[model samples]
Target chain A: MSGIRVSLRGKSFPDASGNGTRQVLGELGFVAERGEFVAILGPSGCGKTTLLNLIAGLDAAYEGEIALDAAAGNAAPDIGYVFQNPRLLPWRTVFENVCLVLNAPAGATALVEKFLAEAGLTEFRDAYPEKLSLGQRRRVAIVRAFAIAPDLLLMDEPFVSLDGPTAERLRAMLLEIWNACPTTVLFVTHDLDEAIALADRVLVLSESPASIVADVPIAVPRQERMAPAVLEEFRKRLRQPEKV
Target chain B: MFHLHAIWPRLASFFLFLLLWQLGAMALESRLLPLPEAVFAVLRDGFQSGEIPHHIGITLGRVAASFVLAMAIGSAIGIAMGRSRLLDRLFDAWLVLFLNVPALVVILLAYVWFGLIEAAAILAVAVNKIPNVAVTLREGSRALDRDYLEMAHSFRLGSLRTFRHVVLPQLSPYFLASARSGLALIWKIVLVVELLGRSDGVGFQLHLYFQLFDVASILAYTLAFVAVVLVIEAVCFRPLDRRALRWRR
Candidate 1:
């Protein structure tokens, strides 16, 4: 699967009050090569979400140009976003919610069933979202994001607010899907270890009115990504007082 | 099978109401307040002659017509107002004015302008209900979840799909609320419109009986119409309400 090249230059949003504007992204520019997974890590209240919003085209009230250049053979690069919450339509059953994004065709039923099974939600496919546990809802959201076969998938802390085991399980599920159907993923999170474990490259941002402080690449092999020594070394390098 | 345990309380309350009315009639000892037995006899006579059913049918048709019209037009206007600031500002004053104006005035004005036609009667009833439905749905639209809408956008769900999946579910409760309240209000207003001008309806029958001091027949018509309204509430609305809100369980 081909990827997308996202370029943003000087994105800014004005404060709600008539005060001066807040510079969320200051001449920020990055590109995710085809089929690469990039994690954007920043402190809380930073413009991590704002950056994702710009790329996802959710927030258009920003300065500078944000462009998505798709690779050849892909006409329009579809984007799938997983918000901090699952954001499922509570009235719809799990399967129906996934079907909401798919262009209606007879083949959609099989596609939905395949994704539901992949996410361990086959048994709960007919259950309403309100009846599912939070982790299950997040799993459904992940399945929904992948169902559309997006070229650029954006996730904003999809595992946030879950218990430790649930979050870990969801992360593992995400990796399994990513491995199966490779796509350009732009994941936003505040967790350092999560960024290290999941992303090919970690881009750290400064505090509010953020800009890229460091672009750290995890050179360790994929199998050893979570090794204690490797994780300790990266943590030491990222936490240097001079980086901020 | 019907449950006697569930129905006994309602039956007992109805009987108690009838006993109180009978006592009041005995105390007045006047023709103005007929005894329950006399009213029931008139009701039986009206049913045998088929006059009461025909008039009841006409009034119900008006109620249904007005209810559907008001909900459709009001929901459209309410959603428009909620989505657009310009429309909301333009219609805010007009909505408040219509809401406060007496239903009697609107009905009389409609009859005067439209000349006592079915269109005028239905329009009058619908006008009385539109502002209320519009107000309730406007709030619903305003409170719609932006997060879900954002999800739709990110997934590239088109306008129609977004509305069906994201907008309608959130608005269903408001729709149901407006429908319930609108039914109650429209039936009452339709009766007023019928009484003021129409030739055949429960309202017209009551007007005719009023001139002759036929207290028993008037009470009988009132009782019959109330029973029809109660049946609609139980048979049509209650089941639909349960189905629409089944997701809550």
Candidate 2:
């Protein structure tokens, strides 16, 4: 347990959006073995996104310490963030949006092509976001975030607006890509089924100024995880009322 | 592309106006208010005599020079003010002062400063135009989305790339809008400035006609200048506006 890989321990100051300094993560302790998927589930105002921000080093105004094991490599984990909204630049075409991540690398066109193909957006390489449907735009955002091949990927409820079927489809695609790249993914979602469908462990959060109330591990394998009956059990566990 | 069916009523009203003016000429029986046919006759005669083109060329040259100067300087200052609140605040009082003060006053001031030179006329027109462009673009820049800018930062795009790929595209509509109105207004002011200060151009020509109380010649010159304004709207502003808005459905 002590040899576990990535972990963070800190209390972050609430943001300036009148998000008061409430103990969101509350000396939050978690450890992920290498290549693990963690689903963080919480209510709407819960600071689930804030926790991911801390992990991504985007928010440093915090009280406690957070560290990743850097002993094995010279560089800390490369981080990629997919915001709640698609947030694709309206002026840029889909290919240009993905290729924006290829600053240092060569052959930008080829990399853009690869990701467009992977994201099933090759037909839209030149299409603007205004032309794309909601689902297509979300896919472009995901591909852009993942195209850089980051060591850690943080997603903040990236499919809130999609239909359930489309969300499920994307979840499967995301799992497929995650398996290939094998990066550490800290996923945040309001949907319990989504959390259970993708994660090795589901961390449930309390309401605003939130704290992690439970971290439930999934014993099932990825292939059998999304089964209707298996998801029902996970849903039942998450539905229980909160304790003080 | 010019829709006359929608404006047929206005056309009818204008024809009625011409008929009324002809009737008024007949009633008053005064040479100062010449009949519409007489003004048309004067226009035709002036065109045949070739003096019309010379006067038109001079007026066109002045308008073109002033319009270009206004667009260049107006757009630059407007964009700068829009991008920086400090600059906007610093220049706000001066801009308001100019926007409120009469164009005639500015032209008079230019005449005093520069003595009827082409530069004086151009400067007068440009000064009138800059505040308008700056105000429109300032609103545009203020309303720019921070989300797009944040995305640019994450991409690590260079300044030129970011501007070309992100900022300018968003700002293109604002630029087109400002340029169109600014062009129209500066040219109108150019004519006024010419009438007051310069000895050449359409305004000066109109003043020469006015002195003789030659209503036919005055109406002829006015119709010619109005036609030029129509040509600018058709040939330049409309097509450019369409191209800039191509991204929209």
Model 1 misplacement above 4 A: A71-74, A241-243, B1-3
**Residues A3-71, candidate 2, lDDT per residue (tens digit)?**
123334446564577757546655466776557788888888777877876666656777665565542
Q: C-alpha displacement of B83 in model 1, angstroms?
A: 1.1
lDDT tens digits by residue: candidate 1, B21-57: 9999999999999899999999999999999999999
Residue A183's lDDT in candidate 1: 89
Cα TM-score per model: 0.96, 0.80
Give me the runs in candidate 2 sitting further than 4 Å from their true place: A1-36, A50-80, A91-106, A110-114, A122-128, A148-152, A180-184, A200-203, A211-220, A228-244, B2-24, B48-50, B83-85
lDDT of 1 by residue, A63-145 (tens): 66656676568676888888888999988999989988886646878988998998899999999998999999999999998
**Highest lDDT against the true fold, candidate:** 1
Candidate 1 CAPRI-style tier: medium
